[model samples]
Target: MQNDAFMHVRKMFPDLSSHRHRDMKVSVATEIKWVVFYRATITTRDGNYQHTIGQRKTLSFKDAKIINLQYCMGVCTRQLPCQNSGYTDPRECSECRCPEGYGGTFCENMAESTIPDCGGELNATSTYQTLQMEGDFQAPSGSSCAWRITVSLEGGYRSFYRTLLGRSM
Candidate 1:
């Protein structure tokens, strides 16, 4: 959104720029026009990934947060995804930290992604929160892409998650 934010993000991932452009248009309120644009990049930190959203398109200021998007459905850019990939354009991804029970780029690791959507409570001793994001990712320990996210909390952990759309494997 701001140049300083862009600079800060570019600092984390050198590949990100402050002037990348993408021709993105969305139907917001029944109007089809360029509404967002920008560039984005990701870096591996320890056992997780850290992404920087920047270079917001002046039109929408939400589409220009990624670069070389191989998947486009909500906000990933680039269409004709390679089967089960990034979110479609126009969708904004939130930011959140994954829990121990879940791991992966999108945090959609089944068995670990959710805690049994059937009132299956966890057995931790702290607080529990949800990440600010959603995705249909293929678990690194499983086969086939699963439509899940780093949702829910366990171990009674504290609130350290935000809904952010992202792609992971």
Candidate 2:
């Protein structure tokens, strides 16, 4: 790998100096559409029997136990994990976040904050709600993302508690 691939990479990326260490990569050397993929067939005899299946790329930039796709998978048949680190479970991500007033691993643990308040019960279900947002703002206000949560108490059992993680960006 260091003999041929390294030379090719050095020629392709001139910015890479001799002292700098580079990462290994995997890519599709050619375009191939499993001949053709039809309902229940995987034909390879193009002119004759052809299935209609799509193509996939096994592109991994790093040499880890996992595969990657930074260039984005056009039509991947198999689901791939993201290349980002420090991420726990991407799926099943429903957990109460402990903001400034609280702190912990999954944001599940809470503590008293410098911002004093008449503490009582935090009813998450009734006091707060969840909303989906998609956008990045330049300024603040109407665009400013500063927000605080409220608590609603129904009885011995708390109901409403909300969290706005990562200021709207």
Q: For each of the candidates, give the backbone clash count.
A: 32, 21
Q: Candidates' TM-scores? A: 0.16, 0.17
Q: For residue 84, give model 2's deviation from the true position in Å.
A: 21
Off by over 4 Å in 1: 1-65, 68-86, 89-123, 126-141, 144-169
Residue 64 lDDT in candidate 2 = 17
lDDT of 2 at 137: 20
Q: In angstroms, how far off is 36's CA in candidate 1?
A: 34
Q: Cα lDDT for residue 85, model 2? A: 21
Model 1 score (lDDT): 0.25
**C-alpha RMSD of candidate 2:** 22.7
- Candidates' C-alpha lDDT: 0.25, 0.25
Model 2 misplaced regions, further than 4 Å: 1-102, 111-114, 118-158, 162-169
